[model samples]
Target: MNIQPLFDYIRNHVTLTSEEETFLASKVSYRKYLKGQFVVQQGDVCKYESFVISGCTKTYYVDTEGQEHIVMFSVEEWWTADLGSFITQTPADYNIQCIENTELIMISSDDIEELYIKIPKLERFFRRVIERALAASQKRIIRSFSMSAKDRFLYFREKYPQIEQRIPQYMIASYLGITKEFLSKIKSQIILEQ
Candidate 1:
Protein backbone atom coordinates (compact mmCIF):
# COMPACT_ATOMS: atom_id res chain seq x y z
CA MET A 1 0.00 0.00 0.00
CA ASN A 2 1.10 3.56 -0.70
CA ILE A 3 2.46 5.49 2.30
CA GLN A 4 1.84 8.90 0.76
CA PRO A 5 -0.87 9.68 3.26
CA LEU A 6 1.49 9.15 6.19
CA PHE A 7 4.12 11.32 4.53
CA ASP A 8 1.52 13.98 3.78
CA TYR A 9 0.40 13.98 7.42
CA ILE A 10 3.97 14.58 8.59
CA ARG A 11 4.70 17.16 5.90
CA ASN A 12 1.67 19.15 6.99
CA HIS A 13 3.54 19.86 10.24
CA VAL A 14 7.19 19.62 9.21
CA THR A 15 9.15 19.57 5.99
CA LEU A 16 11.07 16.39 5.31
CA THR A 17 14.06 16.13 3.02
CA SER A 18 14.13 13.23 0.52
CA GLU A 19 16.73 11.35 2.56
CA GLU A 20 14.84 11.95 5.77
CA GLU A 21 11.65 10.67 4.21
CA THR A 22 13.46 7.59 2.96
CA PHE A 23 14.90 6.90 6.36
CA LEU A 24 11.47 7.30 7.96
CA ALA A 25 9.99 4.96 5.39
CA SER A 26 12.54 2.33 6.30
CA LYS A 27 11.89 2.56 10.04
CA VAL A 28 8.13 2.17 9.90
CA SER A 29 6.27 -1.04 9.14
CA TYR A 30 2.70 -1.89 8.18
CA ARG A 31 0.27 -4.40 9.62
CA LYS A 32 -3.29 -5.43 8.90
CA TYR A 33 -5.68 -6.32 11.74
CA LEU A 34 -9.01 -8.03 11.42
CA LYS A 35 -12.02 -6.68 13.17
CA GLY A 36 -12.17 -7.59 16.89
CA GLN A 37 -8.40 -8.02 17.12
CA PHE A 38 -6.62 -6.37 19.99
CA VAL A 39 -3.66 -4.23 19.02
CA VAL A 40 -2.80 -3.53 22.63
CA GLN A 41 -4.42 -5.23 25.60
CA GLN A 42 -4.70 -4.07 29.15
CA GLY A 43 -1.75 -5.45 31.17
CA ASP A 44 0.40 -5.77 28.04
CA VAL A 45 3.17 -3.31 27.28
CA CYS A 46 2.33 -0.97 24.44
CA LYS A 47 5.22 -1.39 22.05
CA TYR A 48 4.18 0.59 18.97
CA GLU A 49 2.61 3.86 18.05
CA SER A 50 0.25 3.32 15.15
CA PHE A 51 -1.21 5.51 12.46
CA VAL A 52 -4.45 4.37 10.88
CA ILE A 53 -4.22 3.93 7.13
CA SER A 54 -7.65 2.37 6.72
CA GLY A 55 -10.58 1.45 9.01
CA CYS A 56 -11.05 2.29 12.68
CA THR A 57 -9.86 1.36 16.18
CA LYS A 58 -11.04 2.10 19.69
CA THR A 59 -8.90 2.73 22.74
CA TYR A 60 -10.83 1.88 25.87
CA TYR A 61 -10.58 1.02 29.53
CA VAL A 62 -12.48 -1.66 31.35
CA ASP A 63 -13.78 -0.83 34.77
CA THR A 64 -14.13 -3.11 37.80
CA GLU A 65 -17.76 -3.59 36.92
CA GLY A 66 -16.68 -4.93 33.50
CA GLN A 67 -17.92 -1.94 31.59
CA GLU A 68 -15.92 -0.53 28.73
CA HIS A 69 -15.33 3.18 28.56
CA ILE A 70 -14.00 4.34 25.24
CA VAL A 71 -11.27 6.91 25.66
CA MET A 72 -10.68 7.57 21.98
CA PHE A 73 -11.37 6.44 18.47
CA SER A 74 -8.86 6.47 15.63
CA VAL A 75 -9.93 6.40 12.03
CA GLU A 76 -8.08 6.90 8.78
CA GLU A 77 -5.37 9.56 9.16
CA TRP A 78 -5.61 9.32 12.95
CA TRP A 79 -3.12 7.93 15.44
CA THR A 80 -3.78 5.56 18.36
CA ALA A 81 -1.77 4.17 21.26
CA ASP A 82 -1.60 4.17 25.02
CA LEU A 83 0.99 6.94 25.23
CA GLY A 84 1.71 6.49 28.94
CA SER A 85 2.48 2.82 28.52
CA PHE A 86 4.40 3.33 25.30
CA ILE A 87 6.61 5.97 26.86
CA THR A 88 7.17 4.24 30.17
CA GLN A 89 7.34 0.67 28.85
CA THR A 90 4.76 -0.38 31.41
CA PRO A 91 1.56 -2.39 31.16
CA ALA A 92 -1.24 -0.56 29.40
CA ASP A 93 -4.27 0.51 31.40
CA TYR A 94 -6.35 0.66 28.24
CA ASN A 95 -6.92 -1.63 25.29
CA ILE A 96 -6.63 -0.68 21.65
CA GLN A 97 -8.81 -2.85 19.41
CA CYS A 98 -9.82 -2.84 15.81
CA ILE A 99 -13.47 -1.92 15.26
CA GLU A 100 -13.10 -2.74 11.58
CA ASN A 101 -10.49 -4.51 9.52
CA THR A 102 -7.62 -2.04 9.72
CA GLU A 103 -4.35 -1.24 8.01
CA LEU A 104 -1.78 0.61 10.07
CA ILE A 105 1.75 1.93 9.83
CA MET A 106 3.57 1.55 13.11
CA ILE A 107 6.89 2.65 14.53
CA SER A 108 8.22 1.00 17.64
CA SER A 109 9.22 3.23 20.56
CA ASP A 110 12.92 2.52 19.92
CA ASP A 111 12.59 3.42 16.27
CA ILE A 112 10.70 6.60 17.10
CA GLU A 113 13.41 7.64 19.58
CA GLU A 114 16.07 6.91 17.00
CA LEU A 115 14.14 8.93 14.45
CA TYR A 116 14.04 11.83 16.90
CA ILE A 117 17.83 11.70 17.20
CA LYS A 118 18.41 11.38 13.47
CA ILE A 119 15.74 13.80 12.28
CA PRO A 120 15.04 16.51 14.77
CA LYS A 121 12.12 17.79 12.72
CA LEU A 122 10.28 14.54 13.43
CA GLU A 123 10.67 15.28 17.10
CA ARG A 124 9.02 18.65 16.54
CA PHE A 125 6.24 17.05 14.52
CA PHE A 126 5.49 14.50 17.24
CA ARG A 127 5.63 17.14 19.95
CA ARG A 128 2.93 19.09 18.16
CA VAL A 129 0.95 15.91 17.64
CA ILE A 130 1.06 15.11 21.34
CA GLU A 131 0.17 18.68 22.23
CA ARG A 132 -2.89 18.61 20.00
CA ALA A 133 -3.96 15.26 21.39
CA LEU A 134 -3.63 16.54 24.94
CA ALA A 135 -5.57 19.66 24.11
CA ALA A 136 -8.37 17.63 22.58
CA SER A 137 -8.40 15.41 25.64
CA GLN A 138 -8.65 18.41 27.90
CA LYS A 139 -11.53 19.69 25.85
CA ARG A 140 -13.28 16.35 26.21
CA ILE A 141 -12.85 16.43 29.96
CA ILE A 142 -14.30 19.93 30.17
CA ARG A 143 -17.18 19.04 27.92
CA SER A 144 -18.02 16.01 29.99
CA PHE A 145 -18.24 18.15 33.08
CA SER A 146 -20.02 21.13 31.53
CA MET A 147 -22.14 19.78 28.69
CA SER A 148 -25.32 17.76 28.72
CA ALA A 149 -25.50 14.35 27.11
CA LYS A 150 -27.35 15.69 24.09
CA ASP A 151 -24.84 18.51 23.69
CA ARG A 152 -21.92 16.12 23.93
CA PHE A 153 -23.47 13.88 21.29
CA LEU A 154 -24.06 16.84 19.02
CA TYR A 155 -20.52 18.08 19.43
CA PHE A 156 -19.09 14.66 18.77
CA ARG A 157 -21.30 14.24 15.71
CA GLU A 158 -20.15 17.58 14.37
CA LYS A 159 -16.48 16.81 14.98
CA TYR A 160 -16.48 13.23 13.75
CA PRO A 161 -19.35 12.84 11.33
CA GLN A 162 -17.76 9.91 9.58
CA ILE A 163 -17.18 7.95 12.77
CA GLU A 164 -20.85 7.59 13.68
CA GLN A 165 -21.49 5.68 10.50
CA ARG A 166 -18.48 3.42 11.08
CA ILE A 167 -18.87 2.40 14.71
CA PRO A 168 -21.73 0.93 16.70
CA GLN A 169 -24.17 3.19 18.52
CA TYR A 170 -23.30 1.57 21.83
CA MET A 171 -19.64 2.35 21.39
CA ILE A 172 -20.47 5.97 20.63
CA ALA A 173 -22.62 6.07 23.72
CA SER A 174 -19.76 4.68 25.77
CA TYR A 175 -17.42 7.30 24.42
CA LEU A 176 -19.86 10.07 25.27
CA GLY A 177 -20.40 8.71 28.79
CA ILE A 178 -24.06 8.07 28.09
CA THR A 179 -26.25 5.02 28.11
CA LYS A 180 -27.28 3.47 24.81
CA GLU A 181 -30.93 4.23 25.55
CA PHE A 182 -30.11 7.85 26.16
CA LEU A 183 -28.16 8.03 22.94
CA SER A 184 -31.13 6.60 21.10
CA LYS A 185 -33.36 9.24 22.62
CA ILE A 186 -30.87 11.94 21.62
CA LYS A 187 -30.84 10.65 18.06
CA SER A 188 -34.60 10.58 17.89
CA GLN A 189 -34.86 14.10 19.17
CA ILE A 190 -32.29 15.22 16.62
CA ILE A 191 -34.23 13.55 13.82
CA LEU A 192 -37.47 15.12 14.95
CA GLU A 193 -35.85 18.53 15.15
CA GLN A 194 -34.34 18.11 11.69
Candidate 2:
Protein backbone atom coordinates (compact mmCIF):
# COMPACT_ATOMS: atom_id res chain seq x y z
CA MET A 1 0.00 0.00 0.00
CA ASN A 2 1.23 3.49 -0.81
CA ILE A 3 -0.04 5.02 2.48
CA GLN A 4 0.80 8.46 1.16
CA PRO A 5 -2.64 9.70 2.07
CA LEU A 6 -1.96 9.05 5.76
CA PHE A 7 1.33 10.93 5.54
CA ASP A 8 -0.34 13.83 3.75
CA TYR A 9 -3.08 14.03 6.38
CA ILE A 10 -0.49 13.95 9.18
CA ARG A 11 1.49 16.71 7.53
CA ASN A 12 -1.59 18.94 7.51
CA HIS A 13 -1.81 18.63 11.30
CA VAL A 14 1.90 18.38 12.23
CA THR A 15 5.20 18.66 10.43
CA LEU A 16 7.23 15.45 10.59
CA THR A 17 10.80 14.76 9.53
CA SER A 18 11.39 12.10 6.85
CA GLU A 19 12.75 9.72 9.48
CA GLU A 20 9.70 10.28 11.69
CA GLU A 21 7.40 9.64 8.75
CA THR A 22 9.24 6.45 7.83
CA PHE A 23 9.13 5.26 11.43
CA LEU A 24 5.43 5.98 11.67
CA ALA A 25 4.79 4.03 8.48
CA SER A 26 6.70 1.04 9.86
CA LYS A 27 4.53 0.99 12.96
CA VAL A 28 1.21 0.90 11.10
CA SER A 29 -0.29 -2.19 9.49
CA TYR A 30 -1.94 -2.01 6.09
CA ARG A 31 -5.16 -3.94 5.67
CA LYS A 32 -7.93 -4.24 3.11
CA TYR A 33 -11.59 -5.06 3.66
CA LEU A 34 -14.18 -6.09 1.12
CA LYS A 35 -17.61 -4.47 1.07
CA GLY A 36 -19.86 -5.43 4.00
CA GLN A 37 -16.92 -6.61 6.10
CA PHE A 38 -16.79 -5.49 9.70
CA VAL A 39 -13.75 -3.73 11.07
CA VAL A 40 -15.08 -3.59 14.61
CA GLN A 41 -18.13 -5.47 15.76
CA GLN A 42 -20.14 -4.68 18.87
CA GLY A 43 -18.97 -6.59 21.94
CA ASP A 44 -15.50 -7.07 20.46
CA VAL A 45 -12.44 -5.26 21.76
CA CYS A 46 -11.33 -2.61 19.26
CA LYS A 47 -7.56 -3.00 19.07
CA TYR A 48 -6.54 -0.49 16.45
CA GLU A 49 -7.38 2.88 15.02
CA SER A 50 -7.84 2.76 11.24
CA PHE A 51 -7.12 5.58 8.87
CA VAL A 52 -9.01 5.26 5.60
CA ILE A 53 -6.74 5.15 2.59
CA SER A 54 -9.64 4.55 0.22
CA GLY A 55 -13.36 3.63 0.30
CA CYS A 56 -16.03 4.27 2.97
CA THR A 57 -17.29 2.70 6.19
CA LYS A 58 -20.13 3.32 8.58
CA THR A 59 -19.96 3.34 12.36
CA TYR A 60 -23.29 2.21 13.75
CA TYR A 61 -25.03 0.75 16.75
CA VAL A 62 -27.65 -1.96 16.75
CA ASP A 63 -30.21 -1.07 19.36
CA THR A 64 -32.26 -3.45 21.52
CA GLU A 65 -35.00 -3.36 18.91
CA GLY A 66 -32.41 -4.50 16.37
CA GLN A 67 -32.49 -1.31 14.41
CA GLU A 68 -29.14 -0.10 13.18
CA HIS A 69 -28.52 3.55 13.86
CA ILE A 70 -25.58 5.05 12.01
CA VAL A 71 -23.39 7.22 14.16
CA MET A 72 -21.11 8.42 11.38
CA PHE A 73 -19.40 7.57 8.13
CA SER A 74 -15.68 7.52 7.39
CA VAL A 75 -14.45 8.17 3.88
CA GLU A 76 -11.09 8.67 2.27
CA GLU A 77 -8.78 10.67 4.55
CA TRP A 78 -10.94 10.04 7.63
CA TRP A 79 -10.20 7.81 10.62
CA THR A 80 -12.52 5.27 12.22
CA ALA A 81 -12.43 3.39 15.49
CA ASP A 82 -14.60 2.71 18.49
CA LEU A 83 -13.02 5.50 20.48
CA GLY A 84 -14.20 4.41 23.94
CA SER A 85 -13.29 0.77 23.35
CA PHE A 86 -9.96 1.58 21.71
CA ILE A 87 -8.97 3.93 24.53
CA THR A 88 -10.10 1.73 27.43
CA GLN A 89 -9.60 -1.73 25.87
CA THR A 90 -13.20 -2.67 26.49
CA PRO A 91 -15.91 -4.17 24.30
CA ALA A 92 -17.12 -1.79 21.64
CA ASP A 93 -20.71 -0.59 21.38
CA TYR A 94 -20.32 0.46 17.76
CA ASN A 95 -19.75 -1.62 14.65
CA ILE A 96 -17.63 -0.30 11.81
CA GLN A 97 -18.55 -1.93 8.49
CA CYS A 98 -17.10 -1.18 5.14
CA ILE A 99 -19.55 0.16 2.56
CA GLU A 100 -16.98 -0.29 -0.18
CA ASN A 101 -13.78 -2.28 -0.61
CA THR A 102 -11.57 -0.34 1.79
CA GLU A 103 -7.89 0.04 2.41
CA LEU A 104 -6.73 1.15 5.85
CA ILE A 105 -3.53 2.01 7.62
CA MET A 106 -4.07 0.87 11.17
CA ILE A 107 -1.93 1.38 14.24
CA SER A 108 -2.60 -0.66 17.36
CA SER A 109 -3.08 1.00 20.73
CA ASP A 110 0.28 -0.37 21.89
CA ASP A 111 2.00 0.94 18.79
CA ILE A 112 0.39 4.34 19.39
CA GLU A 113 1.90 4.44 22.87
CA GLU A 114 5.33 3.60 21.52
CA LEU A 115 5.02 6.24 18.81
CA TYR A 116 4.07 8.83 21.40
CA ILE A 117 7.22 8.11 23.40
CA LYS A 118 9.58 7.99 20.42
CA ILE A 119 8.15 10.82 18.34
CA PRO A 120 6.38 13.33 20.54
CA LYS A 121 5.19 15.31 17.52
CA LEU A 122 2.90 12.41 16.63
CA GLU A 123 1.24 12.88 20.01
CA ARG A 124 0.41 16.45 19.02
CA PHE A 125 -1.06 15.28 15.71
CA PHE A 126 -3.27 12.68 17.38
CA ARG A 127 -4.31 15.10 20.12
CA ARG A 128 -5.31 17.73 17.60
CA VAL A 129 -7.26 15.17 15.61
CA ILE A 130 -9.13 14.05 18.73
CA GLU A 131 -9.82 17.62 19.80
CA ARG A 132 -11.34 18.44 16.43
CA ALA A 133 -13.38 15.23 16.46
CA LEU A 134 -14.70 16.02 19.95
CA ALA A 135 -15.66 19.52 18.91
CA ALA A 136 -17.46 18.21 15.83
CA SER A 137 -19.31 15.63 17.91
CA GLN A 138 -20.44 18.32 20.33
CA LYS A 139 -21.63 20.47 17.45
CA ARG A 140 -23.55 17.52 15.95
CA ILE A 141 -25.26 16.91 19.30
CA ILE A 142 -26.33 20.53 19.40
CA ARG A 143 -27.51 20.36 15.81
CA SER A 144 -29.60 17.28 16.54
CA PHE A 145 -31.33 19.04 19.39
CA SER A 146 -31.87 22.34 17.57
CA MET A 147 -32.32 21.70 13.86
CA SER A 148 -35.42 20.45 12.12
CA ALA A 149 -35.02 17.09 10.40
CA LYS A 150 -35.13 18.67 6.99
CA ASP A 151 -32.55 21.25 8.00
CA ARG A 152 -30.38 18.54 9.44
CA PHE A 153 -30.61 16.58 6.21
CA LEU A 154 -29.75 19.66 4.22
CA TYR A 155 -26.73 20.34 6.40
CA PHE A 156 -25.60 16.75 6.01
CA ARG A 157 -25.92 16.95 2.25
CA GLU A 158 -23.85 20.11 2.21
CA LYS A 159 -21.23 18.72 4.54
CA TYR A 160 -20.89 15.29 3.01
CA PRO A 161 -21.96 15.61 -0.59
CA GLN A 162 -19.44 12.95 -1.54
CA ILE A 163 -20.86 10.52 1.02
CA GLU A 164 -24.44 11.05 -0.12
CA GLN A 165 -23.67 9.40 -3.45
CA ARG A 166 -21.56 6.48 -2.17
CA ILE A 167 -24.03 4.95 0.29
CA PRO A 168 -27.64 3.86 -0.03
CA GLN A 169 -30.51 6.21 0.73
CA TYR A 170 -31.77 4.10 3.61
CA MET A 171 -28.44 4.26 5.35
CA ILE A 172 -28.34 8.00 4.80
CA ALA A 173 -31.82 8.23 6.30
CA SER A 174 -30.66 6.24 9.31
CA TYR A 175 -27.75 8.60 9.82
CA LEU A 176 -30.10 11.59 9.58
CA GLY A 177 -32.43 10.03 12.19
CA ILE A 178 -35.28 10.05 9.71
CA THR A 179 -37.23 7.35 7.94
CA LYS A 180 -36.43 6.56 4.34
CA GLU A 181 -39.92 7.66 3.26
CA PHE A 182 -39.45 10.91 5.12
CA LEU A 183 -36.13 11.44 3.41
CA SER A 184 -37.78 10.97 0.03
CA LYS A 185 -40.37 13.59 0.92
CA ILE A 186 -37.64 15.93 2.03
CA LYS A 187 -35.81 15.43 -1.25
CA SER A 188 -38.97 15.95 -3.26
CA GLN A 189 -39.72 19.20 -1.44
CA ILE A 190 -36.20 20.47 -2.10
CA ILE A 191 -36.49 19.63 -5.77
CA LEU A 192 -39.87 21.29 -6.11
CA GLU A 193 -38.54 24.42 -4.45
CA GLN A 194 -35.64 24.63 -6.90
**Top TM-score: which candidate number?**
2
Local distance difference test scores for all models = 0.96, 0.95
Which residue runs of candidate 1 sit more than 4 Å off their true CA positions? Answer: none
How many residue pairs clash in each candidate at the backbone level?
A: 0, 0
Cα displacement (angstroms), candidate 1, residue 171, comes to 0.4
**TM-score for each model:** 0.98, 0.98
Measured by TM-score, how close is model 1 to the native structure?
0.98
lDDT of 2 by residue, 96-155 (tens): 999999999999999999999999989988998899899999999999999999999999
Candidate number achieving the greatest lDDT relative to the actual structure: 1
Tens-place lDDT per residue, model 1, 48-159, is 9999999999999999999999999999999999999999999999999999999999999999999999999999999999999999999999999999999999999999
Clash number for candidate 1: 0
* Candidate 2 accuracy as TM-score: 0.98
